[model samples]
Structures are given as structure tokens and as C-alpha cells.
Target: MTADPRRSRSARHAQPSAQRAAPAPRKEPITVGRIADAALEVVATEGYDALTIRRVAAVLGTGPSSLYAHIVNKDDIDDLLIGRLYAAIVLPEPDPAAWREQVTGVYTQIRDLYLEYPGVSRAALAMVPTNLETLRVGEGILAILLAGGVEPRTAGWARDALSLYVSAYALEQSLVRQRRRNQDQEWVLGDEELLDRFTALPAERFPQTRRHAAELISGTGHDRFAFALGLLLDNLRPASG
Candidate 1:
């Protein structure tokens, strides 16, 4: 009679069956990911300014001492969250056929990502994207510039210029959105109120800005954004060799 392999295999595995079923002890019960997740929860509900180590610990059912075992400080948590978030972003491959479109598309994706995460947008200000995905974005942009015959230095600076533009614009929008939200309950001030305050200034004192009021605030906020993006893209065209 042929022996059943299943029975033989079962007998061999039976010796350490208890141990096999035993739950593995977690290496360092708390982890950086856990701390980051806790922090994200706090930010999602409470906003950026309200995100604190103490609050995160409370969510994790741990004390500050335990959290310290994982993260160094509140700033460390913020940095980790930003880097982790950056790593998850998916940027398109460099396309010489559509380099300008690729660059603008990346910026648009990043803007949408920051706004979706709300509180994290403020923390991202002036911070370099040292994470892999972000660095990849820079690398992809450089590759496209190289394909278009841009100098290495110009390509590098273009990366910085684009990142700065996107980050600064996002931060400003976040601030404006927050300000409006905070005032949502009260009687919202109208654009006329803002213009009235501006025009009330002595004519000679603020003539330039006040004189071009229509020009200054002519379009929807995004209208100016598209214009700024186009202006920057126009500067990237390589001069004839």
C-alpha cells in the first residue's frame, strides 16, 4: 500500500504545532509606521496645529515615554509623515514627447495630494523632498530637461523653481482656506469690504496696487495659477544651438 504524503507531512509538523500556532512576538511592539499612522489620525481630525505627541500617544494607547521609544519628537513625526507621504506618490516616467505636459502634470498631482491631506500641506513648506519618490520627480524632470538640451545647472534650478512654486502656492491656498473656514460661522466679509479698506488708504501711499485693482484680482484663483505655470514653461524652451 502506498503511504499518504499528507499523513506523513502532518505528523512531521505536529511536533512544533503549538509553537507554530503561537503568535510571534512583535519586534519592538511600537513602530515608526504605527506612530506615523497615529499622527495622521490626529491631523486628519484636529488639524496641523493641534497635532501633538501627547495626542498621538493617546490614540495609540501608549504614553509619551513609549512613543519616544519610536520617534524622537513631534518634529520627527512630522518629517516621517511627509517623507512617507512623498514616497507613495506616483510620478509619470520622463517623456520627451510631452516633457512640458509631464512637468505640469506632476505639479498638479502634487498640489492635489497636499490639499487632500490638509494639515500636512503647511508642514511641507520650504521642506525639501528628500524621499525616494520626490527625488525621482526631480530626476525625471532633469532627464526631460536633458532630453530637451537643457544644461545640468539649469535643469537643477528648474527643479528647485518648480518645487518652490508649487509648495508656496499650496501653502497660501491652505492658509486662505483655513481663514475662510474659521470665519464661516460669522458674517463673512465681502470683496467690497477688502477693496474699501484698500482704497481708504491715502491715494499716493498705495497707488500702484489700488490703481490696478481689476488687474490684481481679475480672474478665479486658478486662472492666475495656469498663467504662472505657462510663463514658467515658456522659459524652458532651449535657444537655437
Candidate 2:
């Protein structure tokens, strides 16, 4: 049977619309881990400042409300980020004879790792670590202190101090990095340039600073970090014999 011209035209027009009507395939379910991974990607590509619930949700092809089902809020995401990063570290066993060194080493590792994800350390400033991996790192540090004879009270307080220092330092570095990128600069100012600037200061007015220009401008970050760690450990001596 021959089709009517009007019916044929109507069916031809309807075919394209029908083909487009297939429901969008089901999106993979969002999970806490998936949300955290998307958030980290946001952080990696656009610094921590750019990370937001909407931004991460967009990355996951979902809405912010969907993420709420799996994670609490931005703070929760921050904790997850820290937990994710530290989960990769293989902590050394605590040793009494080497506790100070071990603790310092761990702190250095933590600082380096925190620095890797810009702005993550900012969260570390106020967030008490309740995440499993974060707690594991804290436990390792505390174990070192206890093994070395630090009293429990002192060790607890020291943990707070160390955490504060690492977070502050990492935050500072991340800010500086962000500033450098925004300013379109390359390389941190070299020590010699810093020394020259300091050395050029009027000796009569800033004699102390001028005299110590080399000392003030010297030392790689690691050197300064080791010195600071040493100072902290020295003052933390185990209850004076």
C-alpha cells in the first residue's frame, strides 16, 4: 500500500525527535571517594581557592545536592583531601633512640605532601583530624614522642604545636606560589639577590641586619626547617633527667 504524502512527511519529521528522546544513560553513582577525587582534580587544576561544592559537582556531572548525600560540606571535603594525601605515606616505625629524627622526618614529609595540594594546609589550620588516615599520621608522630620519653601531656601539646607549624608553613608556601603565578613571576628570589638587597641596607641604621645579611638570607628551605625542628626538639627535652 502506498503511504499518504502527509503521513510520510509527519513520520519523517518525528524520527529525529524520537531518536533524541532516549533518556540520558544513568550517570555513575556518586560516592564519597568519587566526590573527593573530583574535588582534588579541581584543586589540582585551579588551586584550592577554586574548589567549591558546585565546582566539584560540575566535575562529577552531578549537582551539588547529590554530593550532600555522600559528604557533609566543604570542611568534610578538606578532611578527605588531607586523608587522601597522607594515606599514601608509609610511616616509619617509632624508635626511641631516633624519635626526634623520626618525628622531624615525618613532619617534613607531611609538609611536603601538604604543599603538593595548594591551599589544603589552610584547612589543616583549624580542622581537627577525625579522618582515619589523618589520625594515623597523628598517631605515628605521637608514638615517636612517647617512645622518646616525652610525657603524654607534653606529647599531646607538642603534636598540636607541630601540626600548627607544618600547616602554617605549607599555607605560606602555597600563598607565595599562588602569588607568583598571579604576578607572572618565575622562581623564588635567589639567595644572592636577597643577600644583596639586605646587604645594601644602610649599615649605620641597620647594622645588625646588614652584618648578618648572608646569615639572614642563607639556607635552603630544608636547612631552615631542620634548624627549626632541632630547636623545637631541644626545648622539648624529656622532663630534665
Candidate 3:
């Protein structure tokens, strides 16, 4: 049977319309969460020092003015970034028997996170623990210390010290990694080279360093980190009943 000319023509037109490329996906709306994600991407790729309000806006394909609706400024972005990072840490139940290990694990987790985004610890160092997530981490640490029978004052001070040490450690590692990336490797010497330099120092001016060069230059990977953390925790004597 011969097809109707009108029907054939209509079918031809409908085929092309059905085959047309799909419309472009709608742009996702900007939100505080999206802003935080874009800001973190900036830090993860370009380092925390490279993160800025304009940069995050650019990353999200928007203008700085748009980001202001969600974030107040770069400081605000820092808080958001820190909160996001802290949110990833799993707080342990305060176990009096394992409080020391729990505390170390928490800080180690934070240190690892900071190292993942080079120089991110700089933001943490500058930030006060005002964000809920940041405060939560502090609370978790304090709970563990208190459960271990550490004095309230000592636990408070210890929390501050641990936070400071972790940030400082991560910052130092990030700086060293940055230097190496920039091909400024002279200051990032190998253990043997560092030991040699320590021993080469004037005997009178650096007697202890020269004598203990190997010890000073020791600690592979995070051995020094563990050792220092131990020193801080070991000194805390649980309050006697």
C-alpha cells in the first residue's frame, strides 16, 4: 500500500527532531556546600595559599559576587574548608583503656588530611575552632583525655598543644614538599646528608649536634611524629583518685 505523502513527510520531520542532540544539562545551583567543594578543589590542586574567593568563584564558573551570597570572604572559605575536612574524621568513643591511642589516631587522621591538601594546615592554624565540626573534634579529644583521668586543666591544655603540633607538623611537611616541587632541594637533604652537615658543624659551637648527628638525623617516614606525640602524651599522669 502507498504511504500517505503527508504522513511520510511528518515522519521524516519527527525522526530528525528525535535524533537532535539532548539539551545541555542544567547548571547546578550554587550553595554553601558547592562553594566549599569548589574551594577545596582549588586547595587540593593549587595549594591552600592559592585558594581565594575570586579563585573559588572562577573555579565554579561564577563571579566573586555570586560566592558572597554563600560565603562572606576568604576567611569564611577557610572555615568552611576546615569544617569539611574535620567532618571526615571519625571520632572514637572515649575509652579509658585506649584513650592515648584514640587521641593519637585522631590527630594522625587530621594530619593526613592536611597533608593531602598541601598547606591546608595553614588555614587550620589561623582559624579559631568556631565551626561546629572543628568544635566537635576538640570535644572528642577532650572527652578522650578526660576519660583517661587527665585533669581538666591539663586536658584542655593538651588539646591545644596537640592541635598546634599537628598543624605545625603538617605545615612543615607541606613546605618541604613545596620546596622539592620547586626544585629547591638543597634544604631538603637526605638523612645521611643531614647527618654529615650536622657533624661538619664547628665542634665548639655545636658539640651536642655534632656528637648526636645520627640521632638528630634519625626518624624515617612518621617515626618522629609518633615519637613527639608520645613525648607529649607520656608526660600526662592520670589524676590519682
Which number leads on lDDT? Answer: 3
CA displacement after TM-score superposition, residue 96 of candidate 1 (Å): 1.7
The Cα local distance difference test for each model comes to 0.73, 0.84, 0.89
> Pairing residues by index, what is the TM-score of model 2?
0.85
lDDT of 2 by residue, 1-241 (tens): 8879999888877757435565888879998889878978988888888889999999999889998997878899988888888888778898989998899989989888888888888767688777899999889888889889998899999989888988888888888777776656655676788788788899899999999888787777668778877888888877556
Q: What is the lDDT of residue 168 in candidate 1?
A: 74
Each candidate: RMSD = 9.9, 3.6, 4.1
By lDDT: ranked, best first: 3, 2, 1
Output the worst ten-in-a-row residue range by lDDT, candidate 2: 13-22
lDDT of 1 by residue, 1-241 (tens): 9999999998887776446566886655678888877877787787777788888888888788998887767677777667656665566776677778877777787777676666576666666554465566667777777776666787788877877777777777777777778856454445677667666767888888778765665676667777788788779766358
TM-score of each: 0.72, 0.85, 0.86
The numbered model that scores best in TM-score is 3
C-alpha positional error of residue 27 in candidate 2 after TM-score superposition, expressed in Å: 1.6
State model 1's lDDT: 0.73
